[model samples]
Target: MNFREFAAKNVHRNVKAYFAYFLSSSISAALLFSFTMIILHPNLGAIDLPEYLIKALNITTVIAYLFLFFFVFYSVSVFLKSRYKEFGILYIIGASKKQIQRMISIENMIISSVSALLGIIAGLVFSKILLAVSGKLLGFNALEFYLPVKAMLITFIAFVIIGIVISIFCSFIIKEDMVLKLLKGTKKPKTEPKTSTILAITCVVLLTTGYYLSVTSSTKTLAGRIIPVTLMVIVATYLLFSQLTIFIIKLLKRNRTLYMKKTSVLWISNLLYRIKDNTRMFFLITITSTVALASIGSVYAYWRDKEAQIDRSFPQAFFFSDIYDNSSMVDEKVNFIEGSLKNEGIKYTKVNDEMKFIIPKGEKDQVVIIKEDTYKKLSSILYLNAANLSENETILAMPLTKHGRKNVVLENIELEVASKLDKGIIPAFYEEVYVVKDEAYEKIKGVKVYFNTINVKDYKNTLNISNNYYNNFPQDNVNKYYNNLLKSGILRATKVAYGVILFSAIFIGLIFFVTTGSFLYNKCYMDIIEDKKKYNQLNKIGLTFKEIKKILNIEIGVLFLFPYIIAVIHYIFAISALKYAFELNIAVPSLQVIFIVLIAQIIYFIIIRKNYLLEIKKSLL
Candidate 1:
């Protein structure tokens, strides 16, 4: 047979070994194609999508490509390493190094071609669904799909280059002495896995310090310490899997009572070697999974909290500020807003109030002062309790206030501080507000600014009204007027912007998760020959199939679950840090994401376990 035929046949024979690698490459290509299609869609620009959204798509596409390169390179290296014995056999049968390199190049090209074709087809099949979902998130009614020629070309070319570069790079991985080493393969004796006591203790200390910093640091300080905290956790996690885990397992082995339990001796002995061999895999999975969970969790939490954030920042449906004291302009705008609301059959309440900006007797900073009657009216409309104040008494409405200050003197009037409000009743722009009794308010002399705050029954449905007012009286400063509809538009735009990010994050996370699973599966089956021999010998020594199955369960279960548990621990600390930094209560969304990932991991574990057991059972037959 010709060299090309030989290479093709080799691939067919090693399909099982190449399957995960093929699947990962194909999926990576498909994702890149789909994202590119969305970015290049003709309708995308027409939809008025925020500029940042487009930028985000481009950035994520670049990131996906980079990840694809890393994943492909890593997978190819692992696959080649697993085939050392096969390479040794070929070398012994007269195949030169140059010929072997040529064979690998041909085989890799064939796989890459087929994978790229399948991926393009898959992208085409799912393009409509993807566009539809993206359109919905972006608030576009329709994102019609046309032929994605550009995306196809980009994806195909990208993967082809990656395949060529990887094949060439991997061809040089074999060493001059690899032939003898590969021939001996599993016949080489393994020394006991060793651990450093110092490193193990260092791991504990680093992890403790990392978790403590994440949970206890204030938002202001956390920003500066993010890099340090992340580095600590990452280093600690590596040591945790490499040194700490092996150290603990060795300690457990020293316990005679626990070590001698039925079947415990069997699995425990096997687990020590397995954990040592797969330490790097475990670390990779844990770190990548933690990143996936934390990213999706943070974005999901922000999306869920968008509405409440708006409510806190904009307390009323409509607010008009007469900053220039232009009564005619204010009157005209208010009339148009009220007329539009009435015309749309919308129910609303309007409250008129004037704020006086006054500097205290000696302080340069100005505090906003509003009368108690207006406060009562606005509070009643907003369904909040109004402060009860007597003459010369005031309520301090400011964020993060200290209660030590007793009173304030504005001009000649002295007002006793009755109580403090953590958040402002009006818009958050008026940072410090003093709600004084009408008698006290009239005595203070300062620049008076009139404001009209309106609360509507169905505020969300006022987009058209807000648009009409904006069209008629377009204002330059958005802060002067708070239209619920306009504010909601901004919120929608923000959602669309973050929604794109969240969508990309979700897909990236899922890709990471699936790749990790594939890596674990490949690692398991790579040692099938060794496991077959080991288990067959045990069978001949009177170990029953049932007992073998029990041992397999413990071994496989730990192989699947240990890394996942560590990832969950890491994710908890990450989400906790986000909570403290943002002051957001996101437990519900965070838990939901964790639960879903856990379910997916459990299902994947079951499938892998079932197939792995079946392969081992063949040895018994």
Candidate 2:
């Protein structure tokens, strides 16, 4: 048979072995294609997407493509390694190296062609749905789905290039290795693996340091610490898997009683090889899983907290600000605000506070004094109980205040402190505010500003009505209160933006999880040949099917769960650090993600276990 026929027959015969690689490649291609369509959509640029957001999407698409390349390369290399003996046999039968290379290339091209087609077809089918979901997240009224010609061309070209590269790379694998080595395959063993004392020590030290930094580092220092700590953790995880874990397993084997347990001898005898062989893979899976968890968790957490931020920053629907020194325009500005809200048919309540900006004669820090009655109005509006104030007592309403200290001397007035307000009810003014009796406030000769806070029943509709005011108002530093009120609209827009980002993160994270799971699945299945040979020997020595199953369970269970357990541990600490830094509770969102991932992993384990046991049964038969 010619090379093409040989290649076709080989793929048809071993399709099971190629299935994981094929599916993952198709999925990756589909995702890339879908994203490319969005990027090339004629109307995408016309939408209200921020330039930075557009740029981020573009960058992530490129990153996805790059990730696909490496992922495909790795899968191909592993699959090729499994076929080493087959290729060696062909070489020994007088098939020229050039013909073998051609056969391998043809096989890869066929697989890539099928994968790319499946991926593009999937993308075509889902592109509209994906775009619609994205549009809804972005709060766009409508986004017509259209498959752009350029997108299809780009995707085809990209995957074609990937196919060529894989083919070329696979050719080198055949050329470099000696025929004898290829024939021996994974059975070739020389020196036994020994634990490295230095590496074990380094692993412990590095991991402890990394975990300590991750746990203790707060948000303020997170940026500076995350990079270095991550590098340390990555290195440490590799070393631990490669040396420390193997060392511990060896120690366990040395425990005579435990080592003599049923099936322990069977599984433990070759555990060292499995651990050593898969150390790098385990590290990769753990790190990738952690990244997926952290990214999706962080984005969801931030998205969940967006509303709280908006509420804190824009407490009132609209607030008026004017220099109290020019008390003349205060009423005029208040009238304008009230009339504007009325024009929008917005039902509203108003809280008015008069304040004087002062530098306590000897102190340089500016402070604002308001009447007790005004403080009560502000408090009532904020749903906070009014503070009881006496003529001789003043309450300090500071945004950022010391916890226990309570005295302030303003203009030689020894004002007895009644209480303190952490954040004033009306957040329009951000100065150190003092609430005192009307008589006390009138006595101070200082510039006065009027704060007119408007609370509407439906602020969203009011925002639309007040759009004219926002556009008309020229933003000077003094008129920030008006500007802040306009911020409510921006907040609404930002919520949609964040929603889109959260959706994107979830999708990207899912891809990572699927790819990682596929890698582990493929590796486990590929080892079945060796497993069957070893287990057959045990079966002849009176090992029952149940014992074989138990052995396989322990082996496969460890293979499936080891990376996940480590990943979850890393994820928890990383999230805890984020929580400490941002002072935001991500517990609910984090738990939700954890639950979903856990469920997915359980399902994957069940499927893989079933398939593995079936393969073992077939091998025995």
lDDT of each: 0.81, 0.76
* Candidate 2 lDDT, 37-66, residue by residue in tens: 876778877766777777778777777777
Cα lDDT of model 1 overall?
Answer: 0.81
Q: What does candidate 1's lDDT look like per residue over 61-151, in tens digits?
A: 8777887788777777877888888888888888898888888888888888788888899999998899898777665665898999988
Q: Write down the TM-score of every candidate.
A: 0.87, 0.84
Q: List the residue pairs that clash in candidate 2.
A: 219-581, 324-448, 324-449
Question: Residue pairs in steric clash, candidate 1?
Answer: none
Candidate 1 Cα misplacement greater than 4 A, ranges: 186-188, 217-222, 320-335, 352-374, 389-424, 429-451, 468-485, 580-583
Q: What value does the lDDT take at residue 535 in candidate 2? A: 73
Q: Mind sharing the TM-score for model 2?
A: 0.84
